[model samples]
Target: LRRQDLKAARESIQAVLKVAPDFGYAQQLAGAIEYEAGALAQAVTHLTRAQQLMPESLAARQLLAQALLRAGDPAKALATLQPVLDGKAVTPALLNLAAQAWQQQGELAKAEALFKRAAALDPADSRTRVALALNQIARGDASALESLQATAADDKGTVADLALVNERMRRREFDAALQAIAALEKKTPGQALAPLLRARVQMALKQPDKARQSLEQAAQAEPANLQAATALAEFDVRDKQFDAARKRFDALLKADPKNVGALLAVARVRQAAGAPAAEVRTLLEEALRANPTEPRPRLALVEHHLAQKDTPAALTAAQEAVAAIPDNPTLLAELARVQAVAGDFNQSISSLGQVAAQRPDSVQAQLMLAEVQMAAKNFDAAVTALQRARALAPRDFTVAQRLAAAQVAAGRPEQALATARALQKEKETAVPGLVLEGDVEAAQRRGREALAAYRAALAKVPASTAVAVKVHGALLAQEPAAAPAFATKWMSEHPQDAGFLFHLSEVAGARGDHAQAEARLQEALKLRPDDPVMLNNLAYMQVLLKRPGAVATAEKANQLRPQHPYFMDTLAVALGAEKQFDRAIELQKKVVALDPKNPLWKLTLARLYLDAGQRAQARTELSALAALG
Candidate 1:
């Protein structure tokens, strides 16, 4: 008590009690020690026994009650203090303790009454008034705060104004908070707490540049204001600059390694930047160690495990998360998705049902249930589930597409057609719409109508390679007679286009004009000789025409794309005809190797082998061919 080393005093007294076993002086000292040490539970145990031994001691009874109040055992504290409070006025210290405990227990009237009584008992004490003002604000009693502010204004002290301004800041009324801080500064210029409050107000207003200036001033004014530095670090995070934010947080952490806020801020910044998930996991794990009760790190750890596709680790994380946030629908939904992927579908279904009950209109939940139903061959149920999902997300293309597919499978093509048609109509009129009209006509089996759709598509976008090809194919289906003219015109219009040249050559060959076909193919080769499709096209056409020097041309195509099945097959055909049977067999073997299921390659390979007098190899190839399809 003399030295005021509460921890040392408690340890020494406890040591004495341990040795002596019945030392009243040591026990009394322990009570005194723990009350000052703020270990209220330990202090209450020591003080209760000490009060029994020293029965008429007012100091022991007061200390015991205050310790009980600090420990949040307010009923016990109230009983201890009732004798002192009833039929008697209380001291400032005893009232402060009783009010603190009552406030913690949510008994605002009793707390505020004690605070008022304490301030009246010590009218000259600014500290008691500051405590009373804080309690008033806590109770939302604005009148008490007004009384305190007037009392502080009447009093001549910077500390009271500083404390009053801080109370305004705690209320998060930044404008009013700023006015209070300005008042404090006007009263006593360049005070530390006012500048700190001004920085906090600037940060709340999202004026980072101003906040930084204010924080710099606060940190300079009171070098111990660690909160200003922490706030500045968060400002960099608000600006989405992680490297700068990380630097600031790391600098703070370097000076005080146990700063949990700095550590947590760094982790949050990394998470926002999509840093490789392992880094995020490491950060959360470290933060969790500092604050085991915090839900954020545990939840983030679950998300990280999911991202890495470690299902078992994810499950453990999710279980911890659900325990922390038992009613969170998002947590339950994510957990169910993990369970489903790991083949625990029953658990997944139960979890999803809970989420569905909580959020019946959730399109994602309904869609997931429908997909699971479809996988389990419950097609009718899947269709019903999808209908609900579609209603929730009426404009969702995926829901519409899947719903149509399910209808078609359930022998409802007309319904499928109707849904597709409705979607097509919406796209045609909707602003910022995306319509593929060809899909609509194709679904209805109207190839000719699809041709018209593609033609219209071309009118809107003439340079679209895919649309031109689509329209050209549709036009050739039943109007081969019109194709040659269209092909000629198209080739003339786009002279450098190899696809148009290929189409033109096909049209010429169909008309039995071999010379014209050859001229077009030559022109295509001149433009892009080594282009894979062009090379394959030329080689195949040469083989079809039985043209002289076909082997040389096919050889060149093969050299450019050795493993291409079409070029390899063409070279095989060319080689076999030239009586280079062994070379032809090798090329044919490669084609079969590339596409084992393509029996055409096996048949060709066998023929080449037979011509090479390799009957065993030929028979093997023939057997492979016989096994296919």
Candidate 2:
């Protein structure tokens, strides 16, 4: 297994398991082999059985936890690690695994502390050092970058080097990323990942031609590299070269007919080209039939049915997938989602309840059940489920917050208020608790109490745009005139808060102060120049003001958030204002298609057609709009 001969190792383990079916050691060996082979479901099942049979085996527990983490069940992973974590024999490896589980749960502070402890225990362990550096980087510690770079330079491993490359790419150092990729390629010769990384870096540098060349080279060097082939096909689709895209997909299918990615890509291309729904559905069904236990194809099939508004079909597909993968959490979640979409709230609740029962140690499962109950307006049941989750994770802010929300929804405002106040006693939840308290008071129409809570939260985190937004909103709801003054004062103190500046712009726009709104938005752009929402708002404002640069501004906004209906609508309106009716009509058609039930967008599409002198198209759109009404 350590030599990477996973297939041989799996076969050897299976032979041992076949002879000694009840032997705990054989089960453990099989589980470890499967885990290394990336068969997480098999790994989890075998490891669980091994743990039950050999209850004292730390190896079984740790391997099971690792498998659960890889399967995206961090709650279960943490639970599996808890016994070891609380024991006297705690190791750096156990701490590192627990840290990863905490990180996945979004408990950054806990994860950081655990990483520090792991690093302290194993100061000579490069992996622990690398993990600590990564955790620090995630927490926005500036010194972590140097630490990570130093670790990467020390030749710790490929993982640390890749981490450095990822960090460089995330920071938009494309040139440095390319150099890192080049170094990695030299260190590990003939790796398909190198060209893929170079291609991504080239694309980030806006060298599309070079990126395409790198992709093609990678595809040629590694014929089985599906990522390279898929990316090239996506590029073809983007350029409207439908035939080229189909050919690429066909070649991929010819090489490996059971390839789920190729199958899904072909289905998406057919959908994009306005093919018959049956044709696309056929492709999705084929993918599902090819890989019954794989979640992606089944989920895609269900999503395709839902997108077509065939709730019955979606539910049936989801049920079939769950029947095939009965123990899989992802497929079960999808089943619940489909049931909820079909308005069978009781069925959704039952499905999630089964998951929670199966994994009683999983806080996530209980939380999911609580969410479904809340959606069904069964607040008491939601609260009950959340309380179970809270018992499992007593210090979890999310579980506590949800419990408070459920109490509020159940009309037990006093209980909710008590929960909120308790949260304020914890350092981790203090500000969020105050915010929640304010929300509860505002919901109950206790205006003064709400204001006081929001003000206290703002005092704790003076630069928090979210708390400031809540304060402004509560003030506005109670006293509209005073709200504007508060926003002005807050903006004066936190001049660099682009989010609050944008909020102030919205207030200015509502009061017919377009000049003030525009000035505020311009100031916000200086802080976050590429913010799509701000760009969209500024474009809409420019269109209303009849500014000549409106089309360009709206184009930039749409480019920033491609295929977003709101941004597309703004661009369409701006184009129409500039008398670019043809493109406006084209864009509006897409916007209306994206939101077919929106009469306003359809009305705009009709107007655009009329402006472009296509009276027949305009009449058709207007008639459809009337039918909608």
Best by TM-score: 2
lDDT of 2 by residue, 1-629 (tens): 88989988988888888888889988988889877665656777789889879988888888988776654456667867876785777877787778767754546467656666766676677866677887788889989878877776787355456556666776788887787778777775644567877887888787888989988876665554456666787788667677787777665566457666667878887776656678889999999888765677898999988876678989999999898889877778889988988888999988987887777888988888888888899999999999899899877778888898899999999998998888899998899889889988988999989999999999999889999998898888877789878887888898888989988899889988887888889899999988888989998888777777877877787666666788999899998988888888888877766656568888888888888788999999889877765
User: What total of clashing residue pairs does each candidate reach?
Assistant: 0, 0
Model 1 stretches astray by more than 4 angstroms? 1-436, 478-481, 503-520, 555-562, 613-616, 627-629
lDDT of 1 by residue, 1-629 (tens): 68887767767787788897566556667877866654444566678777767756667777787655433345556656655664355676667566655643445466656666666677678766776776676778988778667866777754455445545555566787677778777765543445655776776687768878887776555332245555665666556566876775554455445444456667767865546556878987897676554455666677667655677988988777777778777778778877777778778778878888887878988888777666656678778988999899877777877887677666666676566566655643221111244545556577776677677767766765556666677777746677667666776777788777777677678878777778788898888766666666666666667777778887777655544677789888888888888788877876775565567888888888888788998899788767764
RMSD of 1: 21.3
Note the Cα lDDT for every prediction shown: 0.67, 0.80
- Give all TM-scores, in the order shown: 0.36, 0.69
Q: What lDDT does candidate 1 reach at residue 394?
A: 75
